[model samples]
Target: MQLSGLAPGDWVTVQARFTPQAAFLVAADGRTRTYAEGEQRITRLARALRQLGIGRGDRVALLAVDSPEYVEVLLACMKLGATYVALNFRLSPAEIRTVLAASGAQVIFHSARYQEIVDGCRLRDAIQFESGYEEFLAGGPDGGELPAVTNDDDILSISFTSGTTGTPKGVLQSQRMIKAITQSGVLELGLRPGDLIYSGAPLFHAAGFGHVLYGVARGGASVIMPQWDADLALSWLGSGRVRHATLVPSMIIQLLEHPELAEADFSGLRSIMYGGAPMPTSVVRRMADVFGCDLHNGFGAGTEAGGQLVLRPEDHRRALAGDEWLLGTIGRPAFGCDVRLLDPDGAEVPDGAVGVIASRGDTVMSGYLDRPDLTARAVRDGWFVAGDLAWKDQEGFLHLAGRADEMIIRGGENVYPVEIEDVLGGHAAVAEIAVVGEPDPHWGQVVTAVVALRDGHGTPSAAEVKEHCRGRLASYKVPQRIVVVANFPRNPAGKIDKLRLRELLAEGRIS
Candidate 1:
């Protein structure tokens, strides 16, 4: 076990169980950066971070896409015992500020494309790539002379989680937590050495970091798309070879929509894991059709000790064939993770009742970064409570209804907004959909859906959409209003921005 006195920057040692010769990454520039290259870059970057006054427990924001440099910064920060916050490059500068302010990051790094953006920031230092980075490293850090290895509080990262219902919270993950999640994920998810893992999520989230650790832990190859592009993703998948990948449901939808997809090859995919947002039932069907690989649904977050559940491919297929209900379920807990449902009173609820889902296991996070009250509320009685409400059937399969706060109280009836949203998400025109509670005089608060239509698709009027839902959902559950727009605002992790969605609705921006 890593005890105290473990410094991250100087005299730090991360003897990766996976070797450095392995092809670690395929960068956006089409350059293949191997594990050895990653290691060398990390060592150099450590020098750079230290030069910028980063120290153990200090927060540094890495705002970039899924490039080799992203992983390099992660390595440098971990080596220094500094906390690195991975910010989504897709976020607006204001949203980025929200995460940066929340993380208390002392240093910020950006790509050449975002130089102007970073230059405008009030950061102590906004470093760029290559020449700038090399010059920074050339300058001696506080340590002086050659780099020294040390260990401290392996608090390597403070990954922010924008829970579906509340303001974002930084989930504290140690070097050990990253190692633990990858170990279990590799084993349970069947990530093998020599396997090629296609990663599409923004490098800012825990799932993204998990891919890095998984690659390093197993000496695997990572096929990175700096940005999630469905066409490029299909091309990669079509160039058939043994591979694995992780994705969100939306990415899957785009892949299925690709004209070249049906003829493309999926035989190369050995394993595929997805779980960040809810998996729309219709999208799950499309997954079976387009990606004939061993696909599974993994339900997890940066909280509750990290990785919590896995719906194995065989189980997913079997369940789907036998009972369509499994389509919405996040499946059972992953190997070695203990999961259960708990009421607000901290008591276990019956199998069929929905309550806050809780987990206890090695894969759990250390705690919220520097927030004791928040930490205590999340972890109670040895169980790390995820604010999501879910229920398990008699067979032990878990169905994630939605977040506890996301549950709408309409005219005294408790309704999970996801249930109605899920029903409507199946429509052909609904490309992206987020359901939120809006002000309602009679019902106190009514369910509202802010939708983004598919490209070139004419958006259905609010009345028509409501009628469609009326056919499928109860009157109480139908969306009280619908806002058709070009795009729904998203957080770094690409989850719907309901917090801002609520703000827009409150301002009478949408009926």
Candidate 2:
């Protein structure tokens, strides 16, 4: 995959010239665009943005739901060498303002539904999707020369973190990073020409954008879902048009619970890639039985780092056949990436010893935008410390222990939540589980389990749940208290929000 002189936007132009009539983007509402058509639209948008005084290094923020226009604006920014900032639609006005101020975005492009939010944020030079956006494009010359974007080091996008722990920081991604990610996707995810990729994940995040970019790089068509709808997803799968797709565990659970899943035709589906959370082994097996397609579980790559590791389809098969333990592994380091398990002092830990997960590669972000101190702390000796605690197995598979920030100290004993969650997740009654440390006057922090029971199953007593883990986990790791909920609050990326669970517990709401 020679990517020289081929930024994402430049790749789009190349695809258009070579496969003019090939479908490039299919919107959720049935609108479709060929590669040639998408290129023209992007060119016009780029020209309009340039006319508005946005050029190389200028920050352009977008606050909207997923749509073809969202992708167009992203490509437009790439074409004009402007750094694109994708604001999470679920963020509060204050949070949005903070990110905008940090990025110093010159203009904000938002959907009509977000007009009030955009107004309340008081963003300068905002363009509304309904009329202002079209009018803005109409005012610019469509065929004008775009800014030369030859430098691969130019910042391409700034993706904000999920802010689960604290305020989200803007991750500065360069053309080089995106290109590396695109190639990783092609090589690892099996993206190829003629494959129709369907992605419902929010394009504001790296996972979603990587999906779209992979399809473009492979000259494949992509179906963009504005939002996840289990019924609509089933319909698309049954349509036999979608060859591959990426989904979160929550979405997979919904699909499994949907009534139409049994009747959905998945014979044409080639691969299903899932991540964003730990998946239950039972659910993985059920998906394989139902779809009869390859199931891949992966982790590591986030906004700061591109795809770093992948548990390929073959690994899933191995787990299914009896090495069920492999399902828990995040697989080996991806191509062009180097992963290490390091101690606090930055020394490499021996294999099979738990340590902080760190990676260094072409796909890693340049740095956190404008946070030199944080950049220095996160990227040391050219390696980006992921803050995730994991140990490499003898087989070279990386097994997640938990986030270092989420580690629980119970009666002076260090306990990783994932260890308890993994044990409890296998219980028949538990559908979803998140373990958190609740401040305790005696023990410093008590191990608390917040659980959501599987549908059609009654909630098991806290004692029963604790007894199930008695043999599997250390005594200190067992949940001191279990609180059952209807559902776990999730971040935008569909990962369970442990922070929110702690808040609910503190508020006496989840008891």
Candidate 3:
């Protein structure tokens, strides 16, 4: 039977029964578990959770890094028909309190490292992963039946936004959404059984959680990295055991800069999957040259929607063949998704016209938890829109035009920062660049470029950077002001914090 037809929680049983002894998890610290062992532990954990008074529809929260225990807790929630809430570990105490208060989680599991923080949250029961977690798991009776997963629409997890623009909203992730994403990854992204995968991203984020689940969903093994380390990752990649891996642009950049790039044996590596932010074209090309493997880039998949658009490996090959415009696109609609560019009136926009993205699919979240008003505004009919803007090319590929909220209206003309940033980022001296609109007296808003130059490259004056964009972009689209910086401020989600950047500039922190 297809895994798509079953609840995501049942995927473990399918793999465990069929693949039994196959490795399900391999931690960076040398911890390992086979499918049978993982299933047994998950079953016990489900019963243990029941003993703690957590049942159907109840919420269980986790505040920790990526680990096998994290994966087990998520599965345990699924087995009991409970909702798992993965909170960001990087959040401050106040922010953490805000999320906990909103989520109303019955129990929170934290690592020893976060015991102090969890104590401040004042939960009724805060189980430490290493200290009390094992004891808690052992408390369950050996042979008890878990709840049946009957409803596909049941909330499986609550994923919070990165809070770049404002307070984080809890996006309800359903079992159906997880199943859809799992099927999409297996069919569209070529995830296969027996493929040893490595995903070091934080489990709180969708990509991190999805990558970890994909391995179990496909009867493969996932190599867990508690946190990303370039040196440790390069060694894992060279082991000739890891077939698939998930990384972000920043992680890839660090891996490229590592001295082992030239010596690492990636012969067994089949694909490199990256997402969460835009990748510089230069870095993309360098990664392709160094890794010599299939490159997959996911685009437009947020907490609300699991998988929407994907730039497949073949798309990267085409870009290498001089179809450079393809690199700017996020590829076509993903499997089982309907992606449309719509005007304000909800009508589909014509090709080549910039419009807001509206997606409808099984992968779309059920709704925002406890915010029906906001949910109504975000999801109309069956389509979900989150203010992301893009234009469809003639070949049906979509090129991002920045977020609708991030668009700059310069002198009444709309200017997308992505177009300008892409041109400036290709310059040899620039390592990373961000374009934002600054408040202006006459023009209402002026385009400003914040750039971080590569090492050994002398700083280019504002005029020189502007000159590079002269013919490549229209005069209105060109940046009106330039500010150089050593690095950018990143939000908890690892995305460049443009909102914070604007704040810093207004305060005269960056010149």
Task: Rank the candidate models, highest TM-score first.
Answer: 3, 2, 1
Q: What is the TM-score of each predicted model, taking all chains together?
A: 0.85, 0.96, 0.97
Between which residue pairs do clashes occur in model 3? none
lDDT of 2 by residue, 453-497 (tens): 887888777678768877788778888787888888888888899
CA-lDDT, candidates in order: 0.72, 0.85, 0.85
Superposed model 1: Cα runs more than 4 Å off: 1-20, 47-55, 90-105, 116-125, 137-153, 163-167, 427-431, 450-475, 480-483
Q: Name the candidate, 1 or 2, with the larger lDDT value.
A: 2
Cα deviation of 129, candidate 2, in Å: 1.3
Candidate 1 residue lDDT tens string, 1-511: 1222433232113333235465777764456877656666667678776666777778888877666766777767777677788876765677667777778776887788877677766787777764476676556343322243433226777777654456667887766566567667778767766677776776777777677666666667677677888888888877675388887766776787777876787888877787677666777776876777777888876544777888888787785687777776788888778988988788899989988889887567778866899889888766888788888999899877888767789899988877877788877788778888877888898887778777777777778777777767888888767778776666666677777778877887765
**TM-score of model 3 (CA atoms):** 0.97
Per-residue lDDT value at 237 in model 3 = 88
Model 3 residue 454 lDDT score: 76
| Pairs of colliding residues, candidate 2 | none
Residue 399 Cα positional deviation in candidate 2, in Å, after optimal superposition? 0.9
